[model samples]
Target: MKTILFKSKLIRLFIAFLIFASCSKDDESSTVDIPTVNYTATNFDATFFQTGNSTAPTIDWNGDQGTFSLSAPLAGLNIDSINGILSWDKTLPIGIHNLQVIITNSAGQTVKNITLSNPLQGVFTGFIINGNSEHLEMEFFSDGTIIVKLEDSGSPPTAYGTWTKNNTTIIANLTNPENGVQASFSGTLTIDTTAKYTGNLYSNPNLTDPLGVFEVVLH
Candidate 1:
């Protein structure tokens, strides 16, 4: 009877050990660890102008993943999905434009607002004569009004005129208050940091000045 009781007690201990081991294995298998993810972005703002071979500026960004999108469609610009690259192959209208860019991932998302300025219609200062390095200022407004000023030695010391632009050309009717003479300038304008307009000058409506070569360089 003593021997049978000892064997029964040993069997119970073995069963309990097996149950505990099985439970330990199940708990270890069910346990899982997850990693943390972070998403971030940088902002941007810039100025540009319409040109013959204009390229759009890009926004610098980081921690981007998944999909990328723009708030509105630009006429001649596009954004890359995998990479944040703003592309511009054509010219845009002269004005201030606003846009928003969004980057999304499984972790989170980021948004950035962009302001772009096209300063094609702005005031520029330079020289009006090709060979003469004199101070001349020109203003091109958005309302189709243009003003040109030349600094000369006189009572006012300044000669002013009004002009208009058609496409890439400018036609100006200038007035000399000191000499009481009116002249006109017709030229093709090249817009840049150092903008220029080169063509002919007309002292009279029917005749062009033989020595007049209207060339203006931006300051």
Candidate 2:
């Protein structure tokens, strides 16, 4: 009779152990980790624009929906708390500025680093070689405008266009006023004391046409 009771108690304990193990397994499987926050907007990390740019850039977030806040109050910038949009109304200073954004959600909080700047606003003189080399001057304006003079003899600009910089890469899109020929100059800046920008000139914006190499120095 004692053996029977012992056996019955052993069975009940085994069944209770199985139930507890199953419950623990279910709890472990049901756990979900927090998703990491990331930037979803285009041109948010490092954006370089000319000074007095009326069109402002925005910073949008992805992953967990959250509240947005800046590290400190920027002088010429504004941030939307709910939507995570950063706007500029007043004129920003003409130099590189580092910024940080803090995002807090139900899951967790994170910080992001960003770089904004107004750079490369000066006259660049160089030569473009297709069949023959021709002297040219490219003047980058403070308002995101560009004037390309085919001759360096103090002549008027032969084409007008816009300029933008991305990191160390500089891009200029120009259109001839007389013949409507579109061209683009895209190059990487040389990391030397001379501060020379060297690249090729494409006959079209798609950059498939193989024009000769060109080099320019900022004056």
The C-alpha stretches of model 1 lying farther than 4 A from their native spots are 1-120, 130-133, 154-161, 176-180, 205-207
Error (Å) of candidate 2 at residue 200 is 0.6
- Evaluate residue 17 in candidate 2 and report its C-alpha lDDT on the 0 to 100 scale: 100
In model 1, the clashing pairs are none
Residues 1-219, model 1: lDDT tens digits: 999999999999999999999999987765533222222423332333433322333433333236667878976566777655655532454445676767666545667666555444566665556456566666665554556676665322433566665666677776667777777778787644445667776776443763366566544
Put down candidate 2 lDDT per residue, 1-219, tens digits, no spaces.
Answer: 999999999999999999999999988776543434455432332222222322233333333456778898866566677656667542343346677877776656667676655455677788877777778787777677988888534565489998777766777889989879888988886533455678888888777785777887776
Candidate 1 similarity to native, TM-score: 0.41
Clashing pairs in 2: none
The model with the greatest TM-score is 2
lDDT of 1: 0.58
